[model samples]
Target: MDKRLIKRIAIALCVGPLLWVLFLFYCRPVVALHYSARATESIGFFFMIDYATRKQGMEPGETVVIPTPMFPERDLWILLSFPFDSKDSFEIRKPFSRVDVCIGAGAKVERTEIRHGFFDRFTEPREPCEPPTSKR
Candidate 1:
């Protein structure tokens, strides 16, 4: 190849990965959910999105932390949009039924739960009412 062509190719190679790294680092809005299955039944969950569809199953009383994606482009749009929220659905599957809950955007760590009340005895996992407060 000519010297000018080789120089341009080298520059492109160097800049391509740098741009990708910058995009990945600055663009990805890290959102994660931390939850423990307080109910008596097993719990399974997965993001209802086109890109991420892998199910994560947890046993009764098991604690899990999972990262949820808000595609970089969508996140950008979210920032521009009013309320600055991403309407992402998390499908929680219990033994016989499933429930979809919306997780907000830009939440670094959100504590979730599944509770069983007298009327809804493990019939389904409900969205967390609030994070458990620490006494200490």
Candidate 2:
């Protein structure tokens, strides 16, 4: 191999991983806390958006904190966009269902605070809700 080509290959191998790590450190996406509650009948884990904005199904016990993702690039756009760009600065992504996404958003998601209600009777799981498996 040409000596110059070999040097370029060596530099790339050394710098590639460093660049990737820096990218990861500098590009953290925004994620909000999601609380998953034990639904009635133990049917499945139920989660809500806009915490405390709704009154029903919250019950009064422990809630599983699920760190959910925001719109792609929206989380950082607010902090990086020009000061005059109000729309990009304050918009929040609407909530969607993605068990895997919430579980791995690199945020705290292990806390639980949802409890059983006085009139509600259901068997609570001994462990926190696991991320739903993709059927497809």
Candidate 3:
């Protein structure tokens, strides 16, 4: 094979993934989930996007941070629990936005807050999570 072509291929292979990683970090929004366990036993649930299960686990007081590609205005994300499952899924209206939800007993949303980034944690004006009704 040609030497120049091989060099070009190697460079492309290295740069392609680097660009993708940068895009994911800067463009894609992240989810800072905080599931509080009030029940005696740990709660098990499925973290889903558009009805497809992505992650399933039970973390009581610890915050579950997830970097997501779903857009707040475009897609629908939900949390569905087991054992006491409901017909309706608990919707995460603004996954892209900064929100930490407190799931109380019986898979209910206790509270929601729009927090600041890591650097701005101490800043004031902590907004509430109030996603607008989607057209769909």
Candidate 4:
């Protein structure tokens, strides 16, 4: 083979695999394996019921109600046990009370109530203050 032809073929053989790898890293599906695994792990507990009460700095032992995410109409009340934790990956033992209620899409809150019980030790050990009502 000609020298120029041989040189060009060798360069293409080396560079072609590098370009294909670059394209796979940058242009392929953006989802990472770890992200997909994390999302899958959170499938059942995806819905959240974030809420607050109207009173400012309400002391503990006070009752407060928080709204829950939209759920099917089969059951009216949903008892939620929220495990409180400060960090993303930590053991959460404190239980927080939450209820599931129905409301319009634009409603501020989905009318719910707080359930108190022996689990209070887990749910509300100290003075319990609900979060400010959602503004929607």
Alpha-carbon RMSD, each predicted model: 15.1, 16.3, 10.1, 20.3
Model 1 lDDT per residue over 86-119, tens place: 2333333232111212233232123334332323
Query: Candidate 3 has which clashing residue pairs, if any?
Result: none
Model 3, TM vs. native: 0.52
Candidate scoring better on TM-score of 1 and 2:
1
Q: State every prediction's TM-score relative to the real structure.
A: 0.32, 0.25, 0.52, 0.25
Candidate 2 matches the true fold with a TM-score of 0.25
Which run of 10 residues does model 1 get worst, by summed lDDT? 75-84
Instruction: Pick the lDDT winner.
Output: 3
Residue runs of model 2 more than 4 Å from their true location after superposition:
31-136
Please, what are the lDDT tens digits per residue for candidate 3 over residues 1-136? 9999999999999999999888657654444545554444455666675666764555565456555553444556555445343332456655334555656555556666665454333232254233334796
- lDDT values of the candidates? 0.38, 0.33, 0.55, 0.29
Q: In model 1, where do residues sit more than 4 Å from their true spots?
A: 1-27, 59-136
Error of 2 at 65 (Å): 20
What is the C-alpha lDDT profile of model 2 across 10-94, one tens digit per residue?
9999999999887555433322223334222211222333332212222212333233333343332111111221122122343
For model 3, state the Cα shift of residue 82 in Å: 4.8
